[model samples]
Target: MDFRGRTVIELGAGTGIVGILAALLGGDVTITDLPMALDQIRENVRRNAAAVAAAAGRARVRALAWGRELSSFPRGYDVVLGADVVYEPRCFPALLATLRHLCGPRSVAFLSCGMRRELGAGRFFDTLLPPHFHVELLRRHDDTDVSLYRLTQQHDDTNVSL
Candidate 1:
């Protein structure tokens, strides 16, 4: 997607590579992760500062644990991104809550996951997410067993279980 001049947020950003790339593509990106992970993300952001500046984009690191302090994060980002964030079933409720909070009526989310059956990836993709978002399969890399999905907030909020 064209991220130029758009506001983007990356959830569970580990080293902040994806958020940095989004910033490099001219997005005003906020890369968020747990408090313990902020140092690495900050380091990555610092490393890419020059490129992001040259692209006229902005990158910032923040500590955000899913479903905790939802009110602390501003609502309605233009794009929400998550990479390999669905591995833990115990975190599903929080993750879904975070997604719902971040996405507005016009907001879209792109989530990529390496489908590992042992990790309960299917339960999240097949059951948990469908009730709250309009899920669409954007692409599938067969060789890698990874799938990219595009999700938009469902219009009918009452149907959301979480």
Candidate 2:
């Protein structure tokens, strides 16, 4: 997707790698995680500041605990990214809520997850479907049990199912 001039946000940004890459690719990114991880994410953002600046994009770090305080974050992001964010089953509700709140009518989401049934990761899709979100497989890595999915909120007038 064209990242130029887009405002992006990365949830559960463990090390800020994805956000930094997005910034380098011309997206203004805000990488967020629990407060404990902010320091490291900030460092990663700092390390790539030059590249991000050169691309005319920017990266910043924030602390976001899903569903706890949604009002604190800015809504209507153009893109939302998350890598390995569905590991815990209990966090699914909050995560989905956060996604629903951040993604506007035209926003898209990219979620990368390991397909480990033992971790209850598949439940994410179960939670995602009820919101009338359209989902498609974006990529799969044969060497690993991981896949990425592209998600978008379906229009109210549409009858499509995923």
Report every candidate's CA lDDT: 0.93, 0.87
* Candidate 2 residue lDDT tens string, 1-162: 679899999999999999999999999899999999999999888888988999898898989999889998878899999999988888888998898889888899999998777977766775554566788878878689798988898678655566
Model 2, poorest ten-residue lDDT window? Answer: 123-132
RMSD, model 2, all Cα superposed?
A: 3.3
Provide the TM-score for each candidate, comma-separated.
0.94, 0.91
TM-score between candidate 1 and the true structure: 0.94
Model 2 misplaced stretches (Cα beyond 4 Å): 158-162
lDDT of 2: 0.87
